[model samples]
Target: MRVLHLSDTHLGVDRWFRGAPTEWSRADDHLAAMRRALAPAFAGEVDVVLHTGDVFDRSRPHPRVIAAALELFTEVARIVPLLLMPGNHDRHGLSWHFSALPAGLTVVDKPCALQLAGLRLAAVPFLRDPAVWAAAAAASCAEGVDLLLAHQCFDGSTVPGFVFRPGEQPDTLGVQHLPRGGPVVLNGHIHTPQELRLGDTRVIHVGSTERTSFIERAEPKGALVWHADGGHVHRVDTAPRPMVIVRGPGDLRTVEPEALVALGREARTLEMEAEVASRGGWVASWPKPSPQMPLFG
Candidate 1:
């Protein structure tokens, strides 16, 4: 089975640097990345597009963002089946969207086993508790699951600077909780893309298609194409917005006009940041009171 794996699209996310109402440029950044990520699906290069989680930035996204997401997914689904497992960020919202979502788009949010393209795979969405996730994995074995689509942080998953171990983080899944000996488990949540061999199981973190924050600025954003025949996985690049961090406002003088510039903590004003942003550079207010800013969607 050839699968195009993508995660953490985070549609509808608004950044603080652009000021109160979203300019939709940041949303456009994510949307542009989404197009690159879904290119394979649209071109019939892959049999299925497996989106692990975080379809939207938040559960209750604006109606316009929801419409944009629906339109995109609906388009991709027309080409091939888009298998989605809701992640922690938008599980509740997905539950609502998939209620009347198109037939080509599927919400595999439960511990259910299904056959697709002659592959027996188990679909497990993001579960809040580690034990419950393990239980779901165990139940799927009855169907001889060969692939796992999950949205949880497993042991050894890394973010920008921190690594997650079984006991180190809340809701972290131990390696032992996985189905042993050759079942491929693709995960989400941790934005950094990495693949590790834990015992016989291959845990591949299908990182977000777009950089969600400055922390992921250094990480190469892309999607993974996994061929189940030999368990071989290769990454395909996505053209996400470039995130650049400057030490102070003075540094912005030499910054690239198209880059998402994270201003230094030099006590800058939003108006000043917006002024620089007006010149095509994505200027974000650094060290904002709320840490959830990602410049845009």
Candidate 2:
């Protein structure tokens, strides 16, 4: 009854170099982190592998990224069953590139329940509306320890800037919603791993396998391991790869080439904050003529 939960691998992330890393060296680090994340799933220490969502950053991943994913999951399938769901980042009915993903992986494009030898997996694809998930959960309620796999933000006031929207409910997916109580629920999309309880249900999110966004640079990157029969749940920490951030006012001329190069030396992503300083600092330019910008008139 052992289960390995992993998500938000975000492979083929080509965003970092769009702003920083002229040579795109950070892309290599991203691939390295992805490789490390999959090392354990194929090590034969678990019975099942569940990837809630966001297996790739883009729906149309490069050939190499797709090949790497196929190879990794192909090897993993040799040991255990893998369940993969599509996230908002990588949705279905869009790209044919991801169609080449390995056959051992069960891609859940629509809401459905999959029953394997030692587990029952109820997977839901990327749907912002909570009613969709609620209905799916209600229909999939069955005997045995059912594992709910989803990808969405959760509502937690403690974590600022990353709270679930009005429709997202951590309570609905917990044990209360299930006909039988006590099923392990694993989630993704929130770039930090979390464990909590909701009405006797053990719910957890493994976050992203790699820090694919600049906002997640300071957050922890890891995966979650749990037994389907409810033994013990633990979070395994993965090393945080190097990330870079760059910020300055809207004065590109004032920035030096050496400084920009130095800023990107050890970092992979950039967070630029363009600002304007006049009589009053940090004022945005008015597109239309306004009292604040009387000179434009």
Model-by-model lDDT, in order? Answer: 0.78, 0.59
Best by lDDT: 1
- Candidate 1 residue lDDT tens string, 1-297: 788999999887676544333544577777778889888888899988888889888888777777878888899989888877788898573767644878788776577898766668788888978888888888886657778888888888888678788877778888778765557888788889998777888889979989888899889888988987787888888967667776665666655667777766663666557656765666675555455643433
| Residue-wise C-alpha lDDT for candidate 2, range 20-110, written one tens digit per residue | 3335434455556665665567677777788888888777666777776777777777778877788887875223555555656666677
Please tell me which predicted candidate would have the highest TM-score against the true structure: 1
Give the CA lDDT, 0 to 100, for residue 208 in model 2.
Answer: 79
TM-score: model 1 vs. ground truth: 0.88
Least lDDT summed over 10 consecutive residues: which range in candidate 2?
Answer: 276-285
Error of 1 at 100 (Å): 2.2
Error of 2 at 282 (Å): 27
